[model samples]
Target: MADVTHASNAPPAHLAAGTPPILELVNIAKYFPGVIANENVSLNVFPGEIHALLGENGAGKSTLMNVVTGLYQPDAGEIIIDGYGTTFPAPDAAIAAGIGMVHQHFRLVPRFTVAENLHLGWSETPRRLSGKDIEERASALSKKFGLPITPSAVVSSLSAGEQQRVEILRVLSRGARLLILDEPTAVLSPVEVGELFSALRRFRSEGGAVVIISHKLDEIMALADRVSVLRQGRLVGTHQTCDVTPDSLVTEMIGRPVTLATSYPRQSPAPAGGEAEPLSLKQVTVRDAAGVVRLDDVSLALRPGEVLGIAGVTGNGQPELAEVLTGLKAAESGTVYLNGKAANRADPAMFAHAGVGHVPEDRLKRALMPGLSVAENMALREYDRPPIGGRFSFSMAQARKFAQMLADRAGVKLPGTQVQIRGLSGGNQQRLVLEREIRIASHVLVASYPSRGLDIGAISAMRDMLARARDAGVAVVLMSEDLDEIFALSDRIAVLYAGRLMGVMDRADADRESIGALMSGRNLSEAA
Candidate 1:
């Protein structure tokens, strides 16, 4: 378990400090209608220190951040900057106080250039647009910080990490002394995360304080100077960074202790049903704009009662690969074979029929209709089927029954079947998607980041479902950035880096360290 100083039943105050804290929260309290978001929570961040704010989903971390960043006013509490206690009614107030926050979601204007993005909110007069002054300033900052950002690069052309750096530099250029990054690594590639951590280290060395709010325990163990744990709207405890291990932190974050299972295979895989082949991808090549090959020469095959895992860094054609597999995006070349028949790239309607269930990576964009009711969203996968009935019409009874069953199976905590998907939290929405995909899939299931937004319990449940699927003669193709997820769920792992299939390895042969190396493209070392 992660070594931690667990707080008592009575909430504890910030630890003793030497110099004045750069930022301090005193007895912070926030309430949203019937919900008590945070109750008398306190925290202290020192200069040159990276403070990790740890919590599970709905554990009041976002709420507390919203309060600090001036998105919401705390019902009662004191915020001290440098030394004086203050309250912010607006973001400008927080900005003026040298506090800046970057949200998990990107907010960049896609059409803007990096220079233009950097100068968007500046009060300085510039008769010329995209001027040399702006270029020089951005370039200089990039060089100084080893950021590798091009001043003239279009915002739309930058990767997730580059865009994040742009956000950070924009705030820092305005003389901000403190920064709050909420789940900054959520969208990052493994390489990008390493670079980001290096930059954070440099920033801290220069005396800027940072607070990184994340669910990634290893990251905190590597980077944080002090860690604050929050559970169910209360401060659990605060411990010095060096004193806590990843296992200890995980235990604290989840409230009760958890012994994470490694690459330990349990009962023998069940026998696959009657001689039916599962999935086959033949010569799949996805090309993008500028004639760049997103996926080149991709071919694979799997049998029933097997889990084929795809492990790759983000943006190396994983999304493109999934689109082809899920029937969302067409491949420029090649065909998909389900149950020994060619699949026409006509529509996703075929996947449900072909027994190819797909849980896409982007939940908001691809999987669920956020504006629709949970029932309606779940019914999306069921509409063309018998029970939900549709030669040309609808069966209200079947639809409602199916939706209710799925909602219950997924453990979605919404008001009812009629509750909008938007009303459900991130984890719940993910669970809904999982249930929808798993319930209807016939032969092969391709789940991409299936548990990306789920909590620990939800993640475990999803993993169990995959295990059960393997046990039931279902072919499972899983793709994820989470190493533990890949290790726990996949029987065989395929590494993809730079749109190339590196190789496949047995789950028993792949370790975290090995997979990490392969993910970075040194497959030989990883294999060795």
Candidate 2:
């Protein structure tokens, strides 16, 4: 039990402020074909406040936001903006009402510069501002928001954090007074997250209201003035953040008390040199299609029963490392050894034959067949291996049974394996990937950003699965942009920056400040 003081049924304190709420939802209800997505949900957001919408996946947070942003029309209830009762039939109408949304996946043109991206979809005025004027205006907005982004930088060439800034700036440039951000910190490094928080605070100070949807308890506690919890499409409670604890929020969100400790084995790691390394890379260098070095002289060894966590910002060579390990890309130089066999020239098929399992970052594109049935997708890696199927024929019954067994072991709750894989929630999809990869990976497992979009419960379950694999003597490479994840799961943490390995250190030696400094481009020794 938690010692949290439950929120009152009355309207939030912000409603009592001198000004009218910037945005208000009154008895909002929405429905899908066979489900109620939101039921009688009401919220009040004041100017200069950050209101956090907390919920588990499928808990109706996104649905509620979609309704507010005019992506969906609620079956019941109404919206009020700046004390005016209104309805938005489309996103442009929502924008006209001074409401804007930044979705989890950004909507930026890849080849366009920041200024050009900002100019997109705009009805050019008769004044006809030059490119220089657009860049200057965008640059001023970036500095004003404390994002410090280059207005002339190409969207494709920018880091994840910078691209996120562009998204935020786009909304602000449209004269939005109320901003809605979904999972804003999902892809950011700690430093970038700090910058984002600063920007949010500045926005609030400038009388802009924000509604942020996130599952990160620490972030909600740190940044939000008030939090509203939802479960199963119903508003559970709305409380001042100062009055709640993380445990209380988790309980309200998931209907359970969760243990926060790492589930990985607590035993001392096996000596790196004493065992035959199952996966070893030595001075591996890789180049992109454009002839730019993506990975530079990186080297590491993964011992059986150990998890080597690679931590860095996105576009810092993590993708190249994953590609090299999974045989999706050949290294330009150096050696890759899998189960003590050289895999330098190996393609994905060769790596699969060598017992390498990969759970790619983008599950839909690289790992799972979205249109395929769950059972069929689950058996993708092992269909031709044995009794489940032969070289030419696969037993549907056997495949379903195998998938069910693995799903049960992985704690994946799916309605049926015959359903399309695309219908599963983010957490369940990742669970299916974990189930298949852990079962098929005999030599080594490589999981990139495995828990990126998952809620706390799903993250815990995924960590438990990885720990089980480690306990069963499988070598694991866990690459993530989240430092907390690295600290939780890795026996040793490897830092990557500018496509090079900064340093590798035991978990005991890894500290937030030092790792953050390394991630910000400080030399490892100097950071230490």
User: What are the RMSDs of all candidates, in order?
Assistant: 4.2, 4.0
Instruction: Give all TM-scores, in the order shown.
Output: 0.85, 0.85
Model 2 residue runs over 4 Å out of place are: 1-18, 33-36, 83-85, 124-147, 266-276, 289-292, 312-315, 368-409, 414-424, 502-528
What local lDDT score does residue 333 receive in model 1, on the 0 to 100 scale?
Answer: 82
TM-score of 1: 0.85
Q: In candidate 1, how many Å is residue 225 off?
A: 0.9
- Count of backbone clashes, every candidate in sequence: 7, 0
Candidate 1: residue 109 Cα off by (Å)? 1.6
Q: In angstroms, give how far residue 121 of model 2 lies from its true place.
A: 2.3
lDDT score for candidate 1 against the true structure: 0.77
Q: Write the per-residue lDDT of candidate 2 for residues 1-528, one digit (tens) a residue.
A: 122223423334555535667787889999765667899997788888889998877788988998999999989998988788899999989988888999886889999999889878865422578889989888877776676878888999887788999999888877888999998988887888998999899998888999999988888899998899888898888888887899998999999987656536645555455778877899999998789999999888888888889988887999889889888888899999877878898498788777778999888878998899999998998899777888798899999998898889878766688888865666788898988998777778999999887888888888888877877778889998777788888988888999999888888888998888887788877997
